[model samples]
Target: MFDQKDLDSIRESRQEWESETLEPFLEKGERKERFATVSNHEVDRLYTPEDVSNIDYDEDLGYPGEPPYTRGPYPTMYRGRTWTMRQFAGFGTAEETNERFHYLINEGQTGLSTAFDMPSLMGIDSDHPMSEGEVGKEGVAVDTLRDMEILFDGIDISKISTSFTINPSAAVIYAMYIALADQQGVPREEVRGTLQNDMLKEFIAQKEWVIPPEPSLDVVTDTVEFAVEETPKFHPISVSGYHIREAGSTAVQEAAFTLADGFAYVEDCLDRGLEIDEFAPLLSFFFNSHNSIFEEVAKFRAARRIYSRVMEEWYGAEADESKRLKFHTQTAGQSLTAQQPLNNIVRVTIQALAAVMGGSQSLHTNSYDEALALPSEEAVRVALRTQQIIADESGAADIVDPMGGSFTIEKLTNEMEAEIMAYIEEIKEMGDGSVRDGVLNGIPQGYFHREIQDASYEYQKRVDSGEEVVVGVNEYTIDEEADPDILKIDPETRNRQLERLKAVKDERDDAAVEEMLEELSEAIDNGENVMPYIIDAVKAYVTMGEIMEVFEDHHGAYQETASLA
Candidate 1:
């Protein structure tokens, strides 16, 4: 956006300054080493307009809420309203987690993000033999619709937005949400929520798949189609990069791979004859905000720009909402450390700010002690307060794209865009120009796995060599023992959950549950939308394990053959 004469003048001045000021100072050897970023990119002493001379204001960065949304997605951005503070909270039994949810809502959290326990996430009931010690160890143990009902006991479905962080049993979890909504007398169309129904990422990173990859995709596509027609206000799938990043992908891979998965979903939906505009608007993203402020901001900006172009140019999307990229961001859980765990509060603050500056629609700041255990009540409150201070006191929400037009940020953003586009091109080529084929086949072929492995290997090498410094990890050493009060899973949590499950089973109509399950099975076999059927089954008090067994019987189970070497 700089004039040619002005750019040239600035470039000459920069060169002169570098030779006279920078070079002379370096010759003194006052500084022993060159500066490098967390990504191991060498940092320039200074950035000038010359670095962004090729950028076109109109095309690369028009106004916010416009094409190629490099600036920000919304025109007024946070000035319109601050981003949602959606602190992810779930632990122990449904009653226990429900209390935590109530505490967060009372603590000014704007949205509900549920974290399911391992058993529930794996499509296993609390009483399953395989689920013995893991009932509510990681998150809330949701065995049946009765647990779901207790999970939202006093919560108003129509007034709040709920986001579930479950993958393998997404259909079952979605069924519970819908059934709960129905019982609450809330219209299907009025329900607002997001399901992390992204199965591709599960195969590529998280390893949380229930059915095989191909059939898993069918389930995801079915949810998208059903949401388009039934629950228009709800986001059927939150195509996520958080787990990918947690699994050790670089920032570029996080964006490229996650968006590639989103494209795969689009491909499936389009193949099912659903219009791009119809379901694309409901497509939302989940990204990770690591400690690198500029990199995180650049990554977020690049994601919006690339998604808009892909939607409009590649998918024939017309509506603005269909093309606009909206996302939720969680502070990097991998960045937290156990040693001097209080240091994590500062790390979380920085990461949370990066997410805010990057224009996330919602944010979840990880609890400082999360590296130790499920967040204690005090730790989670501090995490929520981190976002509150950023929004209310920091004055960061007064403008749109606060980092836009800065010389370094613009350069990094341009670099991020180009790199992510290249990755997308590579993924498409791997799939024979179809993102669907590339991701589906690439999973078994270890394409995504190998890339992330290589990136992580290089990153760890940097850390081990002291080229990259983590504050409390390699740089700082505290000899004193940390005595932080940490949250521990209660020993009785599993028993409580199992007892509740037994009660629900005993009280429910067994005949009606069987009938509804049969209907669901028929719909799954007949290629009919199973959402309505699933809703009916959950309402009949079908346990998650039972429903998942039906899916396994029909769709078969998957064992990923990809090697992680």
Candidate 2:
């Protein structure tokens, strides 16, 4: 954007200032020598247009809402409508979580993102022995459809979009949601939400697999096909790189692995005779907004450009919406620190800003105290208000992709694009047609392990050498102490949740439940879509464990014995 004369003048002024003033001052050892961010490629100085000489404005970054959407997804962007503020809320029993959800909605939350406890996430009923100590410690305890009905008791599903953070048994949870919507007098086509049904990421990063790889992927593909026909407004899969980044992948690795997993899903759907345009429009993404502000922003921009090209050029997606990559972002949990807990608010704010600059459709900001426990009401409110303030007062929403034309940003965007493509080529050359195939064969897992090891080693080296400075950790050690009271789930809550599960089990018709389970199993064995039958089982008050048992008997459990090198 700058002319050659202007660039020369800037360089001349910078040299004069550095030589005459900066060097003399720094010679006294009075100022820090490190910059805030490090580039992926080895470089010692600031970037110039020379670094981004190959950028073509029309081809690399078209107008907002246009194809090859490197700028933003919508025409007016946030000026027309701000990104949805989705707070991930759940704790204790369904009733407790329902109260919290109502509180957030009343407090100006634009969307709801449910967080289920480990037992619910694992498809176990609260009454199970395995669920004893973990009924509602992490999130809400959902044992059956009755719990789901209670969870969204007074909420209107058709009015607000909901996102469920679950994997492994995502199909089962999705069925519960469908059943709940039916009870609320909402048609299947009117439901708008997302299911984290990306099973490949589960095996590759989160270690939350239920069935074997092939069968798990089969279930995911089935959901995609069913959603395309039944619930067109709902997203069947949210390919997530958040967990992969949390598991210690670099920013480039995060983008590459996530898009690779997405490509694998697209290939699977095509193999099932589904058109790319039909389902590609419904495909969405989830990513982590980490501490690297500008790099994370560039990562999102590059991801959109690369994904658009892949969809339009490789997959033959003709529609503009089908080629556009829509995504949601959550602040990085790994970036939060327990020490100097209040400082986490600033950390979350910066990360949320990065996500907004990158054109996120929806966002979930982490609370200051999240690293300590499930966030308190005070903490979550602040998190929600962070987005509200950014939207209403910061004036960032007035412009679309405001940082799109910067020399550094454009250069970083191109570098990130090339880095991601290199990884894709590597995965393809490994003899697997896609990353999912490579992951199913345990190749990506090994790659992830190696990358994590190297990153960790480098991080430790930096820390030990006193080159990396953490505010409250290594640099400024304080003898004074500050401990904030955190919210804790009551023990009685678990007891009450268990009692409710048992009461439902005792009151429901045993014979009818058996019949529904039998039908679901038969549907599974016959290779028929199991959503309808699963919904029937949910309505019958069949416990989560019972439904999972049926699937386990038919599909078998995944047993991973491959050791990473």
Best by TM-score: 1
Error of 1 at 359 (Å): 0.4
Whole-model lDDT, model 1: 0.89
Each candidate's lDDT (Cα)? 0.89, 0.85
Instruction: For residues 28-71, write the lDDT of model 1, one tens digit per residue.
Output: 78453777656555667678888898998899889999988888
In candidate 2, what residue range of length 10 has the lowest lDDT sum? 36-45
Highest lDDT, which number? 1
How many clashing residue pairs, candidate 1? 0
Pairs of residues at least 3 apart in sequence or in different chains that clash in candidate 1: none
Q: Specify the poorest-scoring 10-residue window by lDDT in model 1.
A: 30-39
> What is the alpha-carbon lDDT for the whole of candidate 2?
0.85
C-alpha RMSD of each candidate structure in angstroms? 1.3, 2.8
